[model samples]
Target: MKVLIVEDEKPAARRLHRMLEQLELPVEHTVHSVKEAVEHLSNNTPPDLIFLDIQLSDGLSFEIFDHVKVDSAIIFTTAYDEYALKAFKLNSIDYLLKPIDVKELEVAVNQFKASFRESGNPIHNKAQFQPIDLQQIAKLLNEPQNAYKNRFTVKVGEHIKLFATDEIQLFYSENKGTYINLPNGRNYLLDLNLEAVEARLNPKTFFRVSRQAIVHINAITDIISYTNSRLKVKINSFTTFDLVVSRERVKDFRRWIEG
Candidate 1:
């Protein structure tokens, strides 16, 4: 299938592109902002599907609809609250939260294919797709943001453990399990996966440095240059494994660390 990605964050865009490639669905193009997306849509043939981010660098991605007519099927990629996603759910539109899981992405793709087949639309026939109410979606997503998580609860061999977000130095996935590392050098396995854990944490405080790990701003002690344009981040009391920021994330990581 022909695919396009409209995402502001370079790392996120690249990650999504990689995931699509893994699914054997090669993306045809990628645009970073609403302006670029509008221009691309006006100038080139629209793809069969678009993996679109809600917020772009210039504005909400919905603005692109004002300038161009898009007929491609869309799957939203967003960090917005579930309440704000009512428009999508009501419309039978699909969405993937930030730190999207590959399995979930696959399910979404399969659903899209099934819908396409049911509609009997040819590969180049995008006009058969229904139009979406972009204004309504924008209004819903513009509502007040959801509260960030302040603490987490985990089960430890029949015992329960609760820890505040401030106590966390880092969260990492290992052997398909997610664990939180504390400043006291203690580790607790969380019930939620890294994607779910990341969705709850405040983006201003915690940044996902790589696919495997998320680090809190308060936990950072040193930023060292690493091989192949990546970065090595040192977290307080967490030394069991090295935390290397992915090359795709280095630019954003620098911006996050600066703040």
Candidate 2:
């Protein structure tokens, strides 16, 4: 029953620690932010289980997986009621939503103890550390019911033009701002940023390829291996483009391609 809690919020971390005490689980470590968690685990022993929060002050919680081998079970703790929370169950992952329900908490804990504590068969038993699989994770994303972008009419020069999801080639952050590039090779300046567009996109159709690119499904004509662990994508039907996938984004890109 040794546990490690990784959460950026002090109040939330303390509260989780208090609950762990009530559950009679020994708290081995409580580190805030991904950097601290990495340092702690790299220099010391890994814990039996981890209570992880998705968003941190510096980066996403998944960054920890990139740096270390997490053999222990994880229970995602987050305020996200949608995509992030949905990321659980897919990989045999558990989650405790913010303002965590006591009953739900108890149930998650019981399930954890039951699965990890005892051997089920006389034969060889496998450890239940489920890795985060992307195809499975894709199921967690909410699909666009109608289309990628909602209906919108905007003034184009002098006349009003209507736009739909399929009309757009991709969205990019230029000069630290967002803009939509249409299939007709026209770039429309937008106020929204790349991060803002990601959650709005249909996970099946649009992928956040890199920090600056939210590429359209149709836009991707071909993908070729690039230098290092990156990729070079040929965006079909584009005005002018030179988008290169960063090494860090390679994993998500592969997952999106496989999905």
Candidate 3:
């Protein structure tokens, strides 16, 4: 039986491949990131199995299911235990924690083979993420409400300050780190990425104008168009910055705003 490995971390993928080799299983292929996996699955026949990671550099492994059909068994590999618990509740056949154990790897593979014999296809029906997770994810993708604003208090210095979502005009990434531009006339570093914060915020008051920046709808002073299918947003923020809406995400963002 052939197996495909889908993981973004290079070392982890190599290690998993080595362990599977020890199992003497035929390896079909391996790829990193969600985009690469999509390309592979779109063109090639389904492998006998897939060892998938929960998180990719660009998106969640769950997104893979949306783009392609895979009847093969899947064993999720993640570092977080909370996700592992949820995976079990989803009826996933098996999962292995990071720094995968040889014994555990063998056990999961054995279970896959046995289940494949009994069920014909190892997957029950392509694992489905719970609705709550999907809703939270959608909220993260578009405009957000102010629900997350007052609940979170940050300690910026010797003083503990609370900044409401309405006080924040924009969220931007600097050196791959996140910072908040408050309309209250200050800029502060944020605890999480624009992605995580977007998911928790209610989707009525904020909009992710770009992959690295989210602007409060109330913060926008003007909108500008760019040459290459990009958008330039002028918002009431700490500084003047260029927000580029990616070409692939343009239509989705437009529909989201209209919807």
Candidate 4:
């Protein structure tokens, strides 16, 4: 199959390419950022299939469809769970969560193959696939209430402990593992990764300060101006790691804090 990958993260794009290679799928090209993707799609022949990321470096990948017409089937790869419902409205064959599972990838590819076989020419037939309707999906998604996780179950040695969402001060990543800090001055290892944790928690209460940390608004004791237009976050009773929000995220951080 002629496939294309549009992902901003180089490492992730490379890994996905490698996985497709292992599956013996032909990945025609890989483009990072919305501009690059748009340019490529406008200039070159559209691929048969695309593994696309929702959040690109410039903007949402949805912006690409606004600029160019796409006939290829899309398989969305995303870290945020908020867009899950919207993804299916597009010509998405499947939606895969980040830290992509090989088995899941295989399954998604199989589903695409099955659809192709059944429809003969799946891309040209709108009945075989859903039309891309991003605006309506976005409007529906923006409706006030969103379901967020209230609690998490974590392992405490041999025993399992239930961690309440309100008790959590911050969620941080270290040594390739995610850990949750509580107001009671205790820390616990969590099986869910930082991306997963970010997606589940209430966005109003929790703000992802940096890639390494997601701090609760209540947990933030102080926010100080840091070097290079960045902001430093001080979490209550946690002093081991110094967290600084990246410069690019400063604007959203300010808005989040103000809200």
Candidate whose lDDT is highest = 1
Candidate 4 clash total?
0
Model 4 residue 89 CA deviation in Å: 7.1
Better of 3 and 4 by lDDT: 4
- Residue-level lDDT of model 4, residues 166-238, one tens digit each, is 8899999888778899987788876556876786788889999889999999888888999999999987778
User: Residue 30 in model 3: shift from native, Å?
Assistant: 0.5
lDDT score for residue 13 of model 2: 76
Total clashing pairs for each candidate: 0, 0, 8, 0
What C-alpha lDDT values do all the predictions have?
0.79, 0.68, 0.68, 0.77
Candidate 3 structure quality by residue, lDDT tens digits, 24-100: 77677889889999899899888878898866778877788778876667777754434334534554336776546
Best by TM-score: 4
* Candidate 2: Cα lDDT at 21: 76
Poorly placed runs, candidate 2 (over 4 Å)? 120-131, 134-259
What local lDDT does model 2 show for residue 78?
60
Clashing pairs in model 2, backbone N/Cα/C closer than 3 A:
none
Q: Whose lDDT is higher: candidate 1's or candidate 2's?
A: 1
Each prediction's RMSD over C-alphas, in Å, is 9.3, 14.0, 10.7, 6.6
**Model 2 TM-score, all chains together:** 0.48
